[model samples]
Target: MKRSKKVFITLMLMICTLSTFLVGCKKNDSKATTKKDFNYYTAEKLKEAIEKKEDIIILDIQVKEEYDKHHIKGAMPTYAFPVKTDEEKKKIDDVLGKLEGKKPIIIVCPRGGGGAENTYKHLLEKNIEKDRLFILEKGQTGWPYEDLLEK
Candidate 1:
């Protein structure tokens, strides 16, 4: 009886330890994937990049009206939604083809948030390199630059 009890307790401890190890590994894996996938640039940093004439493409995902009303100067207006259809994917591919693949791309949306991340994911699905894509930390709303372009 004593030996059986001891064996049971040992088995329980081993199971608990294995579960803890697996949970820790899962957490690390998620963190590593997120770190590997994409990067972010604040509005100020984006402005500086523009000023420096860095070889980057600013891809805006806002609606046409919003884009026409105000957008970062030199930003390409490509409207994108979080959920993409086949036609939308094709459109994105066409736009990407226009740009040099080696150049870094920054995605933006209204209010400096939301749709940009979704667009980033779509870009990844289109096989854009993780290093070459970035999300604007705070979409156009966060941009401090005064000279937003108008239609």
Candidate 2:
């Protein structure tokens, strides 16, 4: 082949390789994966789980006063309500460190609102699997099981 034809072929090959590489390196969204939200467990279900002695971790993120006033029994308190600041986020580290095993983590926020979602997202960022996390339905505010609460 002529030199020009050889160079042209080489260029085409390089372009093809580059195209393949770029396509391969593309950030592909998860396929067939459903968009996830907080897997909420009702207070009733939580009570049942407790009664059945099922393995579960209740992570309470209420402030110290609120938590002391009334909170779920056996809940691991981070005392980091709102969980907005880096320090408050760090507060959860103690409980997070102790969080092991395959038990589902039920997050007990004050109102089961943004705080819970934030904590959930933070946990995901900290390498906790989404499926293993749950937000207490309506949080502590809507929990009707007085017996389950530790005042």
Candidate 3:
């Protein structure tokens, strides 16, 4: 009876741990807004902004190698893709000054994926108002304006 009780308790503990992990793994949407909730700066809109000389900023979070090969003409190199860790998130601070003012900040990720979203959220947490933050709709990969890219 003692052995059986021990086994049952062990099983219960294991199940509880697994359940906790599963719940933790579930995405916490409260910290980050849905994609639709973000201010999506489409490629066409960016192109028009560039042509019109509007005040805007682009932060490229691609890997250094990819960013070196090509990025938006005036985009700042963050080289902080998948900005997940506390350390990685600090990379955004390096360009915090440039993010000031009413200019819109366009986060340019490889494929308009987590990197961009992460960067956008970090900026918001840093107190930059939502109106000044944007995620490039399709990211640099979907940017169709070849001339606007810098090698």
Candidate 4:
């Protein structure tokens, strides 16, 4: 083939290759593959929700004894502390499993608590959305609301 014809063919091939790549890159550019779901509520917001009687679940992530002693009113005790027994492990799994698909899960522990934070991380690793999970910053010990339970 002549030099000019050869050059023209090579340029056309390069153009076609570039076009294919560009088309491939352009595919599905109009929509995002993932959507953000869930919302993280601040301490004040959580309090407000509780006061207003909104749809939410308060999770007490502390030792069962501490929970029994004192915890946020209407909060379900979900002991996330170190598990020393199969029954405890089962309880944790049962609690987490139930909360996994449930949104508005508010996690709290005693004031100056640590266990709930670890459990929160675990839940995140288990594919829990950050927004779906919220930590009651001050925990039960500092919670302004009064504990409603029969002593």
Number of the top TM-score candidate:
3
Pairs that collide in candidate 4 are: none
| Residue-level lDDT for 72 in candidate 3 | 88
lDDT of 2 at 136: 90
TM-score of each: 0.69, 0.75, 0.78, 0.59
Instruction: Order the candidate numbers by lDDT, best to worst.
Output: 3, 2, 1, 4
Better of 2 and 4 by lDDT: 2
lDDT of 1 at 93: 71
TM-score of 2: 0.75
Question: lDDT tens digits, residues 18-77, model 4?
Answer: 999988887756642221222334567877887789878787767878887777677877
Clashing residue pairs, candidate 1?
112-138, 112-139
Residue 38 of model 1 has an lDDT of: 59
> Tens digit of lDDT per residue, candidate 1, span 1-151?
9999999999999999999999899988843445345598888888889989998999987877888778899888786644366665565677877665788898888865457766777788778887888888777877777864545
Best by lDDT: 3
Model 2 residue runs over 4 Å out of place are 1-36
Root-mean-square deviation (CA) per prediction: 6.1, 10.4, 4.8, 12.1
